[model samples]
Target: MDSTALDLGEDNSLLLVDDDEAFLRRLAKAMEKRGFAVETAGSVAAGQAIATGRPPAYAVVDLRLEDGNGLDVVETLRARRPESRIVVLTGYGAIATAVAAVKIGATDYLAKPADATDVTNALLARTDTLPPPPENPMSADRVRWEHIQRVYELCDRNVSETARRLSMHRRTLQRILAKRSPR
Candidate 1:
């Protein structure tokens, strides 16, 4: 444990949903320091359960989990607490998914490597004000690479299955998957 758990008064509660345990602990500690009483869940099921038991005023949800999509949790949370502020974080970001997240009640979408500061700002942002557009949006190649990587993971890293689903030659898919992601 990073630190002794503190009593989180209901008014200051927050829920963090992510599969990365280490990142969860670190973000929980950081959020605690920033005055949120943090509750964490490592899967969509756990997150939905937490929200059902007691919907927090705020949430930070990852886009993917070991068990299911984070969007499900977001939908549950929104249904449970319509006023809650929710931000979606993803290591694999796509414009389509980002738009879907907003439509599903997420207040903001952040591509990962987002830190506690970024999450905090997003969660606390005024709903009436629009956030500034990204100064450097992802290039088409980067987006395609990210999409392929996501689908590859979804296919359990099976090259043949992924290639089939992507309608690409197996060797071509393997070659692209093998290369480092573009900046």
Candidate 2:
């Protein structure tokens, strides 16, 4: 898929799907600066609509969205364009989710807070080559903390619910939440 560098012309189009408004806007602007004609959608429905009508050559989709799972949009894009390069981003990264995304035709599965450059590289890199490691990869502890925070937020910030969901002691979850994140 990465036989060529970043494509130009109409096929240099990119679709970005994410529920985070600020992140979407920032990524759109950055990709546009990188010479892609970018379109964005904030929900799975909207993303699916755009993909069905005109699947772009490149795409960056979040694993979870307010309306639905972003993989639905990924499937839509693949149905329309098997050659499209798709990258899935998620804050709650898990091996099962990554495997599912890849099976459904994702080019790469990246954890949230992925640098725009990393996304671009994933979008353009050849499938046959090993990608360079991210310059600022998250530490294992940081990834764990981020996953916990995401689960905590999804549980509506209820300590007990978060703890139950995470299978951790309520007091331990509280202590972890109370402290600053690890570097």
Candidate 3:
């Protein structure tokens, strides 16, 4: 380890981007201990700068940043390193955005409050296999409701657009969105 850079080398290089200073610093240390040579950025531009210079083998990027969307960072990294394993983290989870991330080369998408363990599992999981089923699956009704909510968010919460895409009447979609979802 270069006491200063803590760099292990290229194969294990990691980039972590998040506007949350505390979380970024914490994860950096945790990842370093796990054998990655970690580098971190707090905003999209900074993250892009580092990614452009040397796209790491792995990355963890927040979906929303103060300056711009973190998806932009993911795109930059993917463009620079096609084989890089990138994980997208978001406080607001939406199916549309998740699909967008995967389409653009993100290896995985995780909702906010993910721990080091969760991130590690996602980062290293085989891309070819399906993830194991949820320990406690959501009820069919709840699943339906969640899918509706995801589409609604993807449509920027525009009731008309969501209704149009869902092929349902505006009033019906509105009623579904308005109802409290089942826990």
Best-matching candidate per lDDT: 2
lDDT of 2 by residue, 1-183 (tens): 232344564678899999999999998988887888899999999999999998899999999999999999999999999999999999877899999999999999998788778888888788999998766777999878988999898999999999999999999999999999999
User: What is the lDDT for 114 in model 2?
Assistant: 83
Q: For residues 103-159, write the lDDT of model 3, one tens digit per residue.
A: 999999998667776777788788888767555666889767877888899899999
Q: Which parts of model 3 have CA positions greater than 4 angstroms off?
A: 1-10, 133-183
Could you tell me every candidate's TM-score relative to the true structure? 0.73, 0.91, 0.69
TM-score of 2: 0.91
Local distance difference test scores for all models: 0.90, 0.90, 0.87
Model 1, residue 111: what's the lDDT?
A: 91
Query: Clash number for every model?
Result: 0, 0, 0
Candidate 3 global lDDT: 0.87
Instruction: Show model 2 residue runs off by greater than 4 Å.
Output: 1-10
The stretch of ten residues in a row with the least summed lDDT in candidate 1 is: 1-10
Clashes of 1: 0
